[model samples]
Target: MTANKAVGPTEAIADFVQQADFSTVPVEVRERALAAFVDTVGVAIAGHGDGGFQTLLSTMRPELPTGRATILPTGERTSAMMAALLNGGAGHALDFDDVADQIYGHPSVVLVPVVLAVAEEVGASGRDALTAYALGFEVCCAIAATMQVREHYQRGWHSTATIGVLGATAAAAHLLRLDHTRTRHALGIAASTASGSRQNFGTMTKPLHPGLAARDAVLAAKLASNGFTADPAQLEGPLGYLAMYADSADPSAVARALGNPWELARVGLNVKKYPCCYNTHRTADAILDLVRENPVRPEDIAEIRLTLEPDGFDPLIHRRPQTGLEGKFSPEYVLAAAVLDGKIALASFHDEAVLRPAAQQLLRRVSRHESAVPPIGSGEWEFAYSVVEVETTGGEVVRHRTDVPRGDCRAPLGRDDLEAKFRDCVTFAGTGLDADKLLDELWQLETTGSAGPLLNLSASS
Candidate 1:
């Protein structure tokens, strides 16, 4: 299959999403996509009662007109747009969602909700949803690849909401079965709605970014399906999305890399082991490693130093967090939790836990430094490396460097580990849903006739 070199950026992406074949997707890619689906669903269900999710629900649920889509765990049926907003926010509320290095943000959190909501609305099969997911993941990564990721990210545009809006639009458009022209219009419309700031990090608004993207994407697709119009050149034209958001935009990158080798198989998703920011995972892994190898009790620790890639430190926005949400972006809080508990768990980020006397004491001794050398990889790949040095009061220094965190594609979580995480998330949320059954259905998600049964399992009884 030759790449469509003649089409414009928006058209190329829209056509790809509209026409991609699920059977052609490699077995490994399909497996990874399903894993992402299961992981995202688990996280969304776990966020059922999150303050941010609840806030959005309270605001939007009452206003939404009647529809068939169900909000996970809550089981509130609403318009696809409303359900996408609610479920997307819930998926990311805890900062526990998965990440992709290529997109520089959470992909599944935004994409999955949009696909599921639209699929339910159209009564599309689970296979249709999975195909949309793979295509959406590809579109998000390809568009992100064309930009100066570090510069764009440092400039405060949250890629999950910004780039992810387009990805979600592609997914929703595909499931809506829009033709190439309408799909292009959907992408263009989504560009206008694409906006989020990293400045909102650590606040309820951070998760709201993806939620907003999901909602807007659904609206963009629905409107496009009904002949709503947008400038087809909105991606690369002067004063368009890439020009405004990116320091240097390569529009050709989008068309050039549409689907020769799917990004789902290439720059794969990073399934998170810890429930905090993906930025904090490598540090958490290093701390766990250091403590496990050498017995360094919290009391025996003198000082801990973290050396990270310069760009990698951008997302660790909170140095001294007063709230649990803030703590997720605080490397200091994560390191403290790791040393104190010997592991960072969902509960570790709770307000009471983050504010504990022991963790606070450790926070005071923790410091961060940026390395002179850039991270070993390209683009946002720099975020994958971290160096941790721990000095104990007993005059011993221990250091560990992590290039691949436990849940990264290079060292993916095994089936058992992923299942355990799903079960743990369900238990933590107190959603009372059957974790085993949900897991089974998600693993076989592509085989299901409709997304309704799978989505229903996520709802509370």
Candidate 2:
């Protein structure tokens, strides 16, 4: 039970995946898993109209092999790998999926797609699917935390794509019922494809990273289940993934935290209230709060000033976004939306939204300042905090600050809010399923017989 006595990184991870199940998972951890399930499915459904997922579906449709698992946005069936690929992309296409500070990435987008796809493919029960998700999510976050994910991310590697692959693989392997040996092979196989670049952040390719991870998870798990071999040692040697990506950290330490604290509970998940890059959320929240307190007229706005810690705005790379996707990475655009549009919704990131003359005018007045404190989590605030200063043409000034957004772990969204978000997403998808009924089925996931009925109930009718 001691850290030092834990097995090698690969072995420990595989053992955890192979052994974790519904009964073994803690109640809160299972609840977190269920939240991920509900949120991811709803977001993926909302992706029906998203450009990225549409483009992907069009591009890959010709080659897709048919199977029984659901394809998320379309309700059609496809191979597990194909379903995972498309579902994952759709889940993240709108940038509305859950976020996690633990991995500094989106965990559910990748893990949920793979779990749903493989669980349906293998006839696994809803409880089993939920358990698989918990297993995968913990493994992914654990690996990223141990690997110094922030640095890995800052170096232009997308941790959601790179680190997320292992999480997807873990969940897929569990749902597929791979043994310890095969699970080790699956984990090692997954590491080989742990690739995604932050350079793709503002492009259609951005959401595709998680899609690729999801598809690869199914590939790795299915391959391993069929006796595909990989040297499980690919995770730790001098040239291994951890050594190449992480700084000084013991694998055993990472192993100890696997389920002890249950990263899902300890680290927490952020169900976003906005559909933009998480980097701009707190600032957006502050802007909305300031506006709500004293509705700031767009015409009277003289300047919008935002203060953030160093590295806080690192991921919001697009200074003046030219496209809707770029706008998601632009704090100026997001803040402008908060003021001019009075809200940030799924439509807020559209090309027309970013191109509106009013939005463009307001974006110019927005400015960002750096705080003297350390970057998020280590600084005086202990998490991402933002200060917004709005000055009017008439010299009236309004100020507001936010330490955590509404949906962040520390300030978690209530069940009603989560369900409301789900209803809105399902309504947006226009899938016609009774959002309330499907939501009830989802909430009773532990009692559902298998993934088949849920997917069937969600099927567009």
Candidate 3:
């Protein structure tokens, strides 16, 4: 591996991937990364039944080449690229996958599926998969820190797919055991292949972004392993990835924080408790809190005013959402559901529930506004901040403000909560697998010889 000074952003990342030792990773980071893997698999199983997953399956299942990689919840063997695409799409179909704060996107949904697919293809051990995930996550955060997230995200780019492609490439390269040079080429190739648009936020296309990113990264790594050529400086060069996607590029941030404290440890993952857009989480939490404390009923509510950061409000584009999918990005519906049920679950976002006359009546009372003041002590890239005020017909006013949501790393979900979520997802997917056995296997993934058992169990009915 070359020294950091001798390389650019792309090469620096490759060098780190080639040299980083799995044993040296901290216990907490590895545990968190493993938890993310478990969470993604659970979510993917639930997502397998989604319309988006069915569409991708129908398109790619027939064309896949012979291979050993398994698509989740289906147990169908297919090419590594096809498996990654299907599994990645499934993991994100519900918008329930874990998120990284620094990346400003869902990292596990993209990285985990690709690493598992490639690891299965090459017979890599579970420990190796864990290491590759850590490397991929670190690379994603390092690269994301260098960009102006608001500017980059506001430009209509889905950072999960755009930036996640590079991270997935790094993980695939590591699992393939590529040397520094090939790893660099893999990153370069992925840069050109990376693409996703936030314009598709409320549609089935939204989940497809991470799926395509996973497929692109696997293809990039395979091509690089076969001596496919690409610009060595594709990340920082003129007309490169950063320059093309982000409003401003800072290659130095990627180099300055290569692996000092490890981004996985410093800027941790946010495992969601709800299966909806992350932007609505804080408001949902606040509304749930208000309802619990004040005994507020849906019928009693006269108006609901939610003040959120401008960037936070941008993705919630469907103010008058009609479908369950669109309701994920609609604060109006999320809040109404929260107030009506006193809890929001996977079933809450269904079209039947979202279109209920009661929920629609409450939606009319909900209104959103942009906050004039920025959140207190928020970092440059941290954007989730909201204040919820509910006015009742009984002449009562209740307000709650939340800077950090319940499932955020700051206030993370407990082990029991995580387990419950996993069970709920497995049941929801109707996979009929024994949740206890699967959970035990995932908890002991690091010591397992191969990921085949886990994948097999997940795919089994």
TM-score, each model?
0.95, 0.95, 0.95
lDDT for position 210 in model 1: 91
Q: Model 2, poorest ten-residue lDDT window?
A: 451-460
Per-residue lDDT of model 1, residues 1-461, tens digit only = 23658766787797687567777767777888888989998999899778888888888756988888868757667888988998889999988889988888999999999988898888888888888898898889888888877778888889999999998899898889889888888888999999898888999999999989999999999999999999877898898888888899788878888776887887687899999999888899988998899878899989998888766788998998888999999999999999888889988878999999998899989888886563333335444578789988978888888878999988889989999999998888886788887887788788888635446663434
Candidate 2, 1-461: lDDT as tens digits:
11334666788787787678688788888888898899898899899888888889999999888787888777788888899999989988888999989888899999988988888888889888888889888888778767778888888888888888998898888888889899999988888888888888889899999999999989998999999999877787667878877766567656776776788777679999988898888988989988999997899999988888778988888888888989999999999988887889888888999999998999999888888663333457876688888999999988888888989998899999999999888888876767887687678887778636347654435
Off by over 4 Å in 2: 1-4, 374-379, 451-453, 457-460
Candidate 3 residue pairs that clash: none
lDDT of 1 at 314: 89
